[model samples]
Target: MFLRRLLPLSRRLFSSNSSNDPASIIAELNKEMESVFGEPPSSTHPNSIDNNVMAAQDSQSVSPKIVENDYGLTHVGSKGEAQMVDVSPKENTKRVAVATCKVILGRKVFDLVSANQMAKGNVLSVAKIAGINGAKQTSNLIPLCHNIKLTHVRVDLSLNRNDCSVEIEGEAASTGKTGVEMEAMTAVSVAGLTVYDMCKAASKDIQITDVRLEHKSGGKSGDWSREE
Candidate 1:
């Protein structure tokens, strides 16, 4: 809870050679922490704890008992209560995320969308516009989501005549402190829902499934892509 930052020693903490003398490493860390926040309990003997044990303890404790809360569930408090994470300290980074969803149109619905003969109008076009709007209004739709200005949002919907299905892909880009995975996913989901709404008259049982984040890039953590 305190602002006693020791970011200067972040690299040292993780890079320390535990194979040579893990106990010594933890002891050194304990000494440094003691200087900042006082000593540990007399019952906690040095030999009783090691790197992994200390890490678990540090991850769970979050108050005067802890000098540095390295990592944990950011959206939850130490007491397991819900709370928003403070992302202000993190540097702004260009963030991009891509998500995909599949809408399996029944025979009648597929014909309507593929032929652009839906009674509600151009099903794919309306879904595209709805997806863009969904990306922009992500913070409003989801609880505890930050309001971020997206630099770009692209929603693409393609119909596959072979399988009578539509594939929806949404990509959201933002130059901010947080990734846009949620926005991308929400866009795809909303677009798929839009398709269902527009074409439900043709087939009420049209299936929408397999919505997932396909890729994410930027931010402090760097780039990541799904294996499949």
Candidate 2:
């Protein structure tokens, strides 16, 4: 009876040590993986574990592709089918996005906006308000967008006397699951529209151009910046 109890205790101690051992744990994990996958994992490169993990993540992640639309809006689609990205499993991170738009107004409209002679109000102030509001309402305005919390939205308008144009720049920041790229773009678009509305009496030939993402930071894919 005494020997039997000691045998059991010795076996228990050996089992616990084996289970806690790194080599034994690795072997057990390999067996488990083989049982599930029906094959042993290849050991191609030891340092490629992170790369493999990233590749697996990329395979499971939702990415966007460009497609043409009737309203001249470029959208993300796959195999001729429009799809919204699912960001459910992504981590929340601090993100900042910036966009710019240029409205090429003729001399008359440019002068009116620059001189603050518009009948409605100050063109820059009204446009700034509109841009901020548009940034907040980005998800509501754009279809299939996820509502996200925004931290800040800023709009800046500048007049180029030599080119006879007005440039609108928008920046949006957030700490959330998704980026504020759409918000920045929407702000720039709305600001340009507001400018056009304020100066339409002077000229109707204003052209909005280059509404695009300038820079973005944070998220899994890392930072991006447009080339000047």
Candidate 3:
């Protein structure tokens, strides 16, 4: 790229070499300088990069972007570092969250599970218990999450014959500075894992999928629900 630009200027300068005046030669050299390194920028030019080292130092000195509260990443600090949020100053409010997941069992495995004929005993009952326990121990499982007292937690499982899957739903409620969204999500995830563990012997192809939060309410962000 530099050679391409320099060649054009060199051709023009050589063509004008017939004018042997000292002032004319100096003018040609200045033009070459301007062509090689772009015209000098004004000191106040907002986007100037004339002083590359100074420009880079200015970029490095720029403050980090502030994260606003429209569901921004609260776990990150102002210095662009990962950190847990401090909920000490926030008001304690009643919060509720619901999460769900699906476990796909093949036709034969689904039949066996539905009939409670698996060697693992009652799959749904055990998964439900696991989900409840998971909700209670969510803080231990996830990093940077606050351990808040939960008011209630419930796990429900339903068999979807049409899809040959078991739908697991978990709801968590708490009256604290933080919401129970993680707890609810953890509950659904653990319950799905429990289902997979108990049924893996019968079918290795069993899949757990579509784990998501379906609803949440009673927080500074207000309420939100997934559109059906």
> What is the lDDT of every predicted structure here?
0.87, 0.84, 0.90
Off by over 4 Å in 3: 1-63, 66-71
| Index of the highest-lDDT prediction | 3
Ten contiguous residues with the weakest lDDT in model 3 = 63-72
Which parts of model 1 have CA positions greater than 4 angstroms off? 1-71
TM-score of each: 0.69, 0.65, 0.74
Q: What is the lDDT of residue 58 in candidate 2?
A: 84
| Residue range 53-73, candidate 2, lDDT tens digits | 999888667443422343433
Cα lDDT tens digits for candidate 1, 24-99:
7677667767767886668866667787688888777756323333356567666666787789998999999999
Candidate 3 local distance difference test against the native: 0.90
Write down the lDDT that model 2 would get: 0.84
Which model scores highest in TM-score? 3
Residue 196 C-alpha lDDT in model 2: 89
Task: Choose 1 or 2, whichever is better by lDDT.
Answer: 1
**How does model 3 score by TM-score?**
0.74
Model 2, residue pairs in steric clash = none
Off by over 4 Å in 2: 1-81
lDDT of 3 by residue, 1-228 (tens): 767876776677677657677677678777777877888876686645558768888778864463333346888666656788998998989999999999999899899999999898899999999999999999898988898999999999989999999999999999989999999999999999999998999999999999999999987899999999
lDDT of 1 at 124: 95
